[model samples]
Target: MATETFLASFGLVGLRLIERHGIDPAHFARELGIPSTALPDARTRLPSALLDSAFEKAARCIPDPAFALGAAECWHPSHLGTLGYAWLSSGSLRTALKRMARYTKTLGQRMSSRCVETPEGLQFIYDHGRGDTLTGWVMADFGLSLIVSLCRTNDGTDLAPALVTLRRPTPATIRPYEDFFGGPVRFGETHDGLLLSWQVADRPLPTSNRELATTCDAILASELATLQNDDLESRCRAHLLHELTSGEPSDTRLAESLGLSTRTLQRKLAALGLSYRGLLEKTRYELALRYLDDPKKSVTEITFLLGFSEQSAFTRAFKRWNGKAPSDYRQSPGS
Candidate 1:
């Protein structure tokens, strides 16, 4: 379930990168013979074939081979507007990273951070999950970007690590890797991890906000609730949510997609106290709120982004569910 959720979140950021590169993703999707509009919702499990094709296409479109890694760095929450601001306002770097690891699903995946005290010092291990072979280079670059971001976030460009470990073996680019990490870089290690001086870990935080931290924790809990159930209902919800933004989400299609009979799928949903339509609507609603909160996106864009027919249709449905128009709800002071 964590894998599915993580994949979906990573896909969202991947889509953002595709758009940021000035590539017509819709056209690219169509060229690949997949529905371009349905991409946002199809995050649950991308067919390996399609994912490879898209990745290849993106590589060709971007002039910089390191585009994916660069995008990951620039889009980090600590650099983004509201999320970054909230992180910088946290009690300490530890607290900031905790908040980030907790709510990072709201942004992307393939990356996570955890802290542990070691006999020598403190370790902050950054883990990135699987991707294509080319992703190895991207991951290496991303790891470097992370170090840079961490130092910049703390306003200390002089930050250096005692030891840096990478999962991949040594390559021709080893020199750049050494330069970035500013220490010996070990390859073919048991894990891709980093070690920080204990002093840095214990340093007092530059920003502290108890109220904001509380709010962030609460939001993470709420998001986790949706993934709590290990029953048929939860599976159905997960499946549908991962596929909805792509098209007219259907129980039959979902069943077929999962290699199950339609009748069996219906039986499963029934056992979970839900139906196909109910789960689909629930998924759409959750994602709608997330997209609507972004001031950078317009209502029309949200409509297409969520796979709705039109702005009016999305508005009408949003009103039916929330008892207020989307724009008004988004603009409300407390919202």
Candidate 2:
């Protein structure tokens, strides 16, 4: 089985910040086991360990232990591609967050986000199992800062979290976090997340473009369907695993990857009582449980990895397949 990977984009943002401070990104990447050439593509799927390694190396070179906070200061919706557009046009911060939690896989495949409502307000959680290394600390900061920054943008005003929580211990001085988030910071929590007042989520986005959001949704939906409509079962599985790991899942791409005519491919699968759709369903079910077993991937991430259009789609399918939701299966004393 392949070791799980993460979107290198999050770290790439930090690398640029390091270089902006006068250090060469290539040299930094080399110190972290990534070729400088390999560092440019934000969408590249790298061993999650490489990001952790790079973050640690970056800490030794940069003066600030909390450089991740600074890097997030440069974040913009455009950095996220379609996911960003979907957010920009969302009807409200709450709706935008729903979109973010749903499609975060497009930004970081192994990263999972959850948004829940509480009496206190809205809580957004960013969870990645990067351990206690400097990379882990930076990633936690980066994730927290990114979302809070987003919340600020969504409201078109300066804002802060009601409470910021980190799984790691408090840094030597909690001032950086408190200063950056403009709120109280709490460490040694079981998870990494930040909270916002309920009002922040309920307000409408001035830039909300429902038509564009719908268009992006359609495009994403088409991509998901394409993954399930492709060539021979054996070749389809090979192509799905290889390209879908980092690229969009498309039937034309799969056929090209297998060097088969689309018609010819259809005939081949039919030879074995297989349909592309059937193969996709079986393959997704097979891979879903496997990916979920890893603490590194949240249920949301596994849904996208398995080519389901949405997390709910994966859950419904899982229920049909095993008579229980994925969470129920995984959380059981024995999966």
Candidate 3:
């Protein structure tokens, strides 16, 4: 299976910062095992481990302790791919922050983000499974600084967080931390996170553009889906989704689409303790729920979309999967 990776746009941001500090990014790239060519392509995926190593190398070689904080200055929405655009067009900081937590996988699977409500404000917590080490502090700072920068970019205000906490111990100099966060900085905290008062998070932004946000949301969803389906089973399901509208995709057609012989495809599925028929059923069920979510798609239309010969057949499959009829499930998706 492919290793967890992130888009190269982030590395590019770091490279730009490196060059700004009078260091050669190419030298750092070679040391970090990153291809010089990969730095310019936003969509190129690089291993997550390399990102951690990059921060570590920078901490060792860079004279400035807070150099990673400059990530905000070099950041552009395009670096984050679709998620960046989705965040830019969000109506409010709350919406934008939640979208970051939601589609974070598009950046790197190892990192996870969450927004929690509190008496003081909304707390945005991020864990990339590396905040305990000395070098990890740089990564944490990079993340928090980028958040503040993106907020300023969209809201056109020097919005400050209510509070900021880093798991790393206090550095020799602290002014940079306070200036970047625009709030009180506390060190040696349980989590590397920041808090935004509800007033700031929920207030509508002047940059609010629902049409663009919605378009970006769809693209982000698609990007995430493609990123997640790296295995053979998922590859088959993706091909099946495109072919389903024509009819039930035969194993022969699917195998051909995947550049495999029918017998070879069957053998491979069996090795993984799966079957071709089972894959088709699961793919149809997955697509069925998505189609049902569209109120405009009638049951009959969705039936054909799943390549079912009859509405009754689709209904039976839907019920078998969810223990509820398609219409009922659509009405109460949580059920």
Residue pairs clashing in model 1 are: 38-246, 41-242, 41-245
Question: How accurate locally, in lDDT, is each candidate?
Answer: 0.59, 0.69, 0.81
Two-way lDDT contest, 1 vs 2, winner: 2
* Candidate 1: tens digits of C-alpha lDDT, residues 105-202: 44333455666767877676665554325555455455545544654565445666778777666665676666566777787776666776666554
| Ten residues in sequence with the least summed lDDT for candidate 1 | 1-10
Candidates in order, TM-scores: namely 0.50, 0.62, 0.69
Candidate 2 lDDT by residue in tens digits, 1-335: 34556555555676777877788887877777776533345345677667667677777777877777876666555466567677777666776776677556556545778888899987888876666656777788877777777777767888877898998787788888888999888888988888877777767668766667766655544433333243245458766765655634776776677788777777877898987667666666656644654556789888777766688988998999768998897664323
The candidate that achieves the highest lDDT relative to the unseen native structure: 3
- From the highest TM-score down, the ranking of the candidates is 3, 2, 1
In model 3, the Cα lDDT at residue 268 comes to 95
**TM-score winner among the candidates?**
3
What lDDT score goes with residue 56 in model 2?
74
> What global local distance difference test value does model 1 have?
0.59
